[model samples]
Target: MTGWRAIIPLNLGRERKTRLAGRLSPSERERLVEAMALHVIDQLRSAGSVAEIYVLSPAEPGFPGTQWLKDTRCGLNQELAHVLGGERMLVIHADLPLLDANEVEALLREADKVGAAIAPDRATTGTNALALRDPGAFIPAFGEGSFARHRTLLPDAAIVVRPGLQIDVDKPEDLELALKSGATSIACPI
Candidate 1:
């Protein structure tokens, strides 16, 4: 049986996307967050290599075909560590609006070749997606220069470069890039 599962960590805080506050209103940011997260889940569902999809958040996202785990309101690393066990898993960020099923399949295929794999952001400083053959292989470092940090932890892990997976919406420029790349969400029309 396949032991691979896709785990998405969502920060369902009211202040989500604070970086975009200067441009978008609070309600708009919230809606965009929800829309992008749902889009990510949809893509993961369509990926044949993904055995299951799980959302780890403080509140229920109300998405079907996904198991929601009520997070402990702790930091990202701690929350992820709480759920890590003896299972092969892929940790995907919820902000990848352009993420597609084929990209996810390619990531899984790469992970199968290497014990672990990571897709770094455009700046090559942050990690957008991480796949591990064993969840407990290394402690997850997910903030600021995480790409290099994760590589330090798992030196042999493959570094994948997929355009769709790299464009995570964190700043105003990121949103613009995602929009220009044909990213569509239920909240904001393309």
Candidate 2:
């Protein structure tokens, strides 16, 4: 209960992953989103530093165990900003299909040493995972070029670089990358 609270912000709306529409069917996209979200939840559950997992989405709690938080309908950054206060928090994107226990532990270790930690995407321009010890003082700034913005905002934050932490499925090529990396079944936590 004293450890960091993990939050995975999900967009379960009709507009989810519209960018990938040309590459995948609507149902396929939804399945991919659900699988990745479940994968993220499972990874958090396996990690020792994660005290609790919360899913912030407008949809019902489709996944078990994690507490459901009704999204504010505001964008991710604004909604997450409201929850960043009063506790140590980890905000991770749900599309990381390769995330495993070791990467989560490493990110936590880096965060513990510094006041905060950030895992940038493969392009090193976006943030895939973020951990904040004194979250009350840090605003969630997730968007285009977020990695540099976050680093500039939190100078003491450790930049954690790992394969699992960096790969996130955003474009059509990213899906190929994940599949090539053997992400055959992301929801199978076992």
Candidate 3:
């Protein structure tokens, strides 16, 4: 199978990661966003199975290796639906602080086997990473409780479970988990 292309949707706005506002200052949240996004991108690059990387956001985060696709303000689902390349599309969240190359490779291997794979967030309600062998066939339904939506849509999809792929920082508790996940970064260390 061909190497996968990773699609990372980064929220670069000042209010990015607003859920963490109570736990982190605005600047801290921004830094956390950048650091986590960069970490995800770094892992993707390290994965030999990933051939390319694309970042979808309003403003470029200045990550060097990724091709920044100017978001059309069309929202996540629509924007992802429009992305066209890559033998297969790997849609991964930027807040996955624990994500590493091993998870990326593992997810892709499962995708190669089943044509589709999903890594549910720690709570098992949302999707943290998705591998679509046929990108056009899936519309990228990511939001609260998205795991069930994708699961219902693609019943045959392989379910990939791993700490590196299952953890994502979104809430106050999630932030703590991320820090404990050996990611002592949230703007120069939490």
Predicted candidate 1 versus true structure: per-residue lDDT over 1-190, tens digit per residue: 4857988998775479999888788888888888898899999989988888899988887789999988888788888887876767899999999999999888877787888889999999999999988777356999999999999988988888988899999889999989888886733632
- Please tell me which model should have the higher lDDT, number 2 or number 3: 2
Off by over 4 Å in 1: 1-3, 186-190
lDDT of 3 by residue, 12-42 (tens): 6538878888888887877788888888998
* Predicted candidate 2 versus true structure: per-residue lDDT over 104-123, tens digit per residue: 98998888888799999999
Candidate 2: deviation at residue 78, Å? 1.4
Q: Count the clashes in each prediction.
A: 0, 0, 0
TM-score of 2: 0.94
The CA lDDT of each predicted structure is 0.86, 0.86, 0.85
- Cα deviation at 160, candidate 1, in Å, is 0.9
